[model samples]
Target: MIMKTEKRKSVEDYLCSFPEKQRDLLNQLRMLIKKTMPQMEEKLSWGAPTYVLEGRYCLQFAGNQKHLGFYTSPATIRQFQTDLKPYKTNEKNTLQLRWDQPLPEDLLIKMIQFRAEEVRRESLK
Candidate 1:
């Protein structure tokens, strides 16, 4: 017997699946990304909202129960470690943005810009 794989939902569907609070937070992040990097393509990747540039992954974010997961390249995380000190971060590329805290718009913009530049550079190579 042959089996079929389930299709993943679009980014909009993924966002809509979350609760109101999480949805609002995710939308804020999405808007910020769109504003900062209008050229990047938005898609659903790894069950989350991902921004891509030149067919390369720029950044991705997912809503969790207590925090939103912000993911980028490890190099970008290391570059902004000091600014991210207050937030919870993993050894890899994940940064946890707590729901109770305000979104660090400026810091997130810098991180997103860094990823965009990195993706652009990689695309040229």
Candidate 2:
């Protein structure tokens, strides 16, 4: 019920939750997400940007006044821990990168690419 709507409208729900001024940063993030994980099915999981490959979730995104939230599987985080230092919120599995500043675009793209590939690879086995 609740979660079904969350999953179905993940990206749209998350983006529309934010104000218009923040759309620029969110759009950049969306583009990089697309560039990095081309083959994944993009959908909503808990009203966020959810990318799934072979039925496995690769990542999700959310926005607030302070920062953008990156909700992803811990396995994916551990796989690219070093590259994550700049954006880490240090909250176990979740990470938060700031909103006012420009994100480390290349690194994010890399992380997405790596994570998507990893999830798909594991699901294949």
Candidate 3:
């Protein structure tokens, strides 16, 4: 007997699965990550849109019921704890971006850049 495997969804498909507002927020985050690190490979990882560098997770984002979750290394979150004070964060390395609030573009860029550097450093070791 032959069995068929489930098809994995692309980032675009995942984004489209959301409501219009959530989709827009997810797209905006996706575009920002792409613009920040065009070299990083983008794909669905852990059921979210993930950006990879040197085969390591650079960053990931997902649309939640009330907020968009920006995930990265805990170190990155600790590094930006001061800057991230205005936003809500959890110990699990998630930075919550509420739909009602403006996207913190500059801060996101900085966090992604820092994550990219971390990936590079890990690749070296």
Candidate 4:
């Protein structure tokens, strides 16, 4: 419900082109994001699906060479550093969420929720 009809269609088409396993993973992640933060807005930006909350870009995700990468603001990176310790992260505060392996669902939900709160705080300032 957070996403517009057109945007949601685009995301569905994009994920459908992948294999079943990949599709399953992407769809699950998409659902988690949408359900966890219904106040956020979803869009396809920069050739990837992005989520905006409280007027700022809160999260971005994309297909990767060997994994799916989820982009988070620097604040989330700093706050979740300990929780994200096991992931292959780049210098830019992006955490690589691998698709071939089972994602740490609980961790992902926490991360997304943290990001949602951060965006709300930023929008207020």
Model 1, span 15-123: residue lDDT tens: 7777777788889999999999999999888878998999888899988777899999998989999999999997689999988787999999999999899988998
lDDT of 4 by residue, 34-113 (tens): 88888888887776788888678998877665787888878788887898888887657698877668878898899899
lDDT, each prediction: 0.87, 0.71, 0.86, 0.78
Q: Estimate each model's TM-score.
A: 0.90, 0.79, 0.91, 0.85
lDDT of 2 at 68: 76
TM-score of 1: 0.90
RMSD of 2: 4.6
TM-score order, best first, reads: 3, 1, 4, 2
Model 2 stretches astray by more than 4 angstroms: 1-10
Query: What TM-score does structure 2 among the candidates reach?
Result: 0.79
**lDDT assessment of candidate 4:** 0.78
Scored by lDDT, model 3 comes in at: 0.86
Ten consecutive residues with minimal summed lDDT in candidate 3? Answer: 1-10
CA deviation > 4 Å runs, candidate 3: 1-8
